[model samples]
Target chain A: MSVPTIKFYVREGLLPPGELTSPNQASYGETHVQRLRLIRALLDVGGLSVAGIRGVIEAIDDPRRPLHTVLGEAADQVVPRYERGDGSGIAEARKRVAELIEARGWRTYEGSPAAESLATALAALEEVGHGRFAEILDAYADAAERVARVDLEYVAHQVAREELVESVVVGTVIGDAVFAALRRLAHVDASDRVFGETP
Target chain B: MSVPTIKFYVREGLLPPGELTSPNQASYGETHVQRLRLIRALLDVGGLSVAGIRGVIEAIDDPRRPLHTVLGEAADQVVPRYERGDGSGIAEARKRVAELIEARGWRTYEGSPAAESLATALAALEEVGHGRFAEILDAYADAAERVARVDLEYVAHQVAREELVESVVVGTVIGDAVFAALRRLAHVDASDRVFGETP
Candidate 1:
């Protein structure tokens, strides 16, 4: 049966209640229960309304379009940071960032959030005094440029216009999530390193 | 006033109403409202109840206690990838991770949530594939290592141990907020790139 039909059965409580097994009782097996729960989760927690959930369920059931393809498209909506060829000269970009920060009405100083974050991570060194921060930032800048260059080169070579656009959008969204999650993981690892030493 | 006290006032409607001059107002000046909101977010969204939020707030506010120190302590809660030290020894970790995936009843070959996340990343290279969803795990490991190394190398060399912890924690947390805000600046870059004449 179609997802809508299944959803209708669930909504009207026509479907057998989950886990009701006895000598005389109606019950859905694990797969049915799982499908119903998954549908519910997609509707409730995943923030898809009934129709969207049905569409998703339909997509999952249809093998012609892989679940991975659908999910990749879905994941693209929330996080995209990896796509390349988005351009801004370093100086112009820095100036624009400074403006954005100022527009937020935050205090501005050499050590201000404005200068520190807007100015390509030079401030990380400033905390330990200028010399050290500068050295590290220099090293980082070189590595970063290489990464960007390589990223651009790869994009140019591998992707066509349509695929590039999709990758750009999806990559940008997922990439941010990836980075944020990674950063959180980093903090967790640091804690583990400091405390966990049972080798 | 203490955070709890501030929250109590806000909840009780004891605080003066904020000026609606700006679109964003929470019945107090930005700082008070922000402090209250931060406390609330920590308590509510962060899964820390009032008491837990209070502890974190106290740690942040107490001049005697450093923020970075607390972060180092908190960071310990993150799970670690326990493979042989070399990246090459990822096989055992892979097996362990596969077991974890199976235990969770997650499908590895299809577009399961986990696969959607880590599959493309795993497919990037053989080493990456070994651990299945190891890309994220490794990205996190790298970010963790970089941040920790930066934290330790820079922080340890400067400041007393007590001061170092506070500064590092504050710096890390604040740096995160700043970095995120700054990264938004990249959108301008992105727009310029997309709209700019083809290079």
Candidate 2:
């Protein structure tokens, strides 16, 4: 990164400034480099705005925030939020989301942002005349549980809480992009075998 | 849906106009109602721009495009595209993507947008100091394959080709959101169980 870009991150409070070596010059340490990399990943890969990046960065810097709180904030920044419309479809979708948690025997908060995100997607599927698509919910939930278990198990070995938090935040955000991309590739592969064609 | 909303979809070429009955009134049918629902779902749920919806509507109207092409286009519109920067990070990322396809024995297109999307995501993970995250990718791929098989099986039973296309398009777009939400929920559950805490 250029000096100007580094200074810009400093101005935005996205990166802490290096130690002052002289009146007008500072020496950046390894931590600054790490922070810059994180800022880039959150912006470029996670597609988070500067404000969203700031929110998660704050959470990361604060040790008092519980693991769940950090994870939720990280998810909030990554997942799309809505100014939800008051429609019957949404109401039905919300009910289905609640039932999914119950049916799966998950202890996740029924009203979490993730739950609302699921509801919005469900409502959209219903509106699109693909209401039957919900039949595959259990299948998707099953797959998701497996992946999430892999995720937690991977992070469990990190000795520092800071590393664990960083792992959770980065994993939650970029992990979504990773899984979505893999799912699309899997679709292409499956469709080819089933339909006897190639892309 | 209101008259003006329907009129807007027609104006945007997202919905076929109703059959003309008189100069001031056109008789709407079941198709119009269904199209309106699709428009609503695409706009509100899929978060597609009007132009994106127009593109998909045109594809849905044209049977000349094969299933793979239409599916690619649908996936293209849903996945976030990038003005990729020429950096060593991205170059390495692309190499890993090709390796993943080869290792998995997938016959999918190497340069498909979905593949590029995955590459971008992996690159981002590398950038954020979690290159090790890719180690768990096979686990994710395994889960994705299961879900994709379920998806193909569900859509295969659709008798009509148009219905199949519709199912694939809606499933690809909304399914990502659904899977993402479920993954977060699963994380919440797994973290609670492993850490002995509640959100």
Candidate 3:
């Protein structure tokens, strides 16, 4: 990380300032290094904005919040909020998302950010004449549930609360990238099988 | 989308020019509208860059290329190429990825984009002192395989090759967003179940 970037993170309250040990020099610790890496991962890999990272950092630093709550909030903050216009397509998509959640027996909160993100994606699909794509919602949900099970199991292994929180944040963000890449790889394999192409 | 944005896409050759009826009158057909919506979804939701989307469009528009070839090229183009700087961490991660692929019996190409992307993510995890996260690779790959199965099944329903190519492109890009969102929702539910939090 560059000096200006570190300064910017400190200025934006995404990272804590180094300890002032000298008149013109400050002493940084391992936490600073670790936080900087996390911030870079979130920005570069997670595609989060500075403000979004700030929200996540704030949630992490708050001691009173439960771990799961912080995780939910941080996950929610990463996705950009979409404005719901008078488009009936989005409304219809939102209803489909609700029905999928109900049918799957998923216990998500009302107005879950993920639900909104799914609705936005569904609406875009409809706009492009792929409204029928919603037919695969159950399949996607099944895979998502399996992925989540593994993720939670991994995070559960962390003994430290701080480490646990940080793990969720990092895992949720970078894990998305990891899963996406794997999905693409799997796509290639599946396509090869379907088209009789040699890998 | 805005006029200038559409103009930029047209200038970039990412979108075809609208039909000209007069000197200052141009009419965009359904193809243009659908392409614009796809572009927006890739940009806004999929978080792909202009250059990346351009490469994908190029692959899709090329008739000589086979379907699987186009899918691989498009997937490769989305991930920002990461240069290995004699870093043992990335090297180690790459090796792990190779092992995971072999153990899973997945027939991915050498230096696959997904492998490179996974290495980048793993290296980042190591940078943040979470290198152990690689231990969960099998679980992730399993879920990814299932998701890809469903994705391919959905795309297989498209009888037209043109629609098949478009489906893979759209499904790969928007599908990432859709899956990521669902994963987050699953995380919330999983966390709730694990932590005994009432949803």
Off by over 4 Å in 3: A81-88, B81-88
Better of 2 and 3 by DockQ: 3
| 1 or 3, greater by TM-score | 3
Writing each residue's lDDT as its tens digit, candidate 3 over B84-195 gives 3435478888888888888877778758878888888888888888888888888888889998999899989998888888888888888988998999999988999898
Clashing pairs for model 2 are none
Residue pairs of candidate 3 with colliding backbone atoms: none
Candidate 2 lDDT, B114-162, residue by residue in tens: 8898888887777767889889999999999899889888888788889
Q: Looking at candidate 3, what is the lDDT of residue B175? A: 90
Q: Give the TM-score of candidate 2.
A: 0.90
**DockQ of every candidate structure:** 0.12, 0.67, 0.69
Stretches of candidate 2 exceeding 4 Å from the true structure: A1-13, A17-28, B1-11, B18-29
Tens-digit per-residue lDDT, A51-123, candidate 1: 5544444444444553224333333222222121123133443554465445543222232322434343322
Q: What is the TM-score of each candidate against the true structure?
A: 0.39, 0.90, 0.94
Model 1 chain A: which ten-residue window has the lowest total lDDT?
A77-86
Q: In candidate 2, how many Å is residue A146 off? A: 0.3
Estimate every model's Cα lDDT from 0 to 1: 0.38, 0.83, 0.84
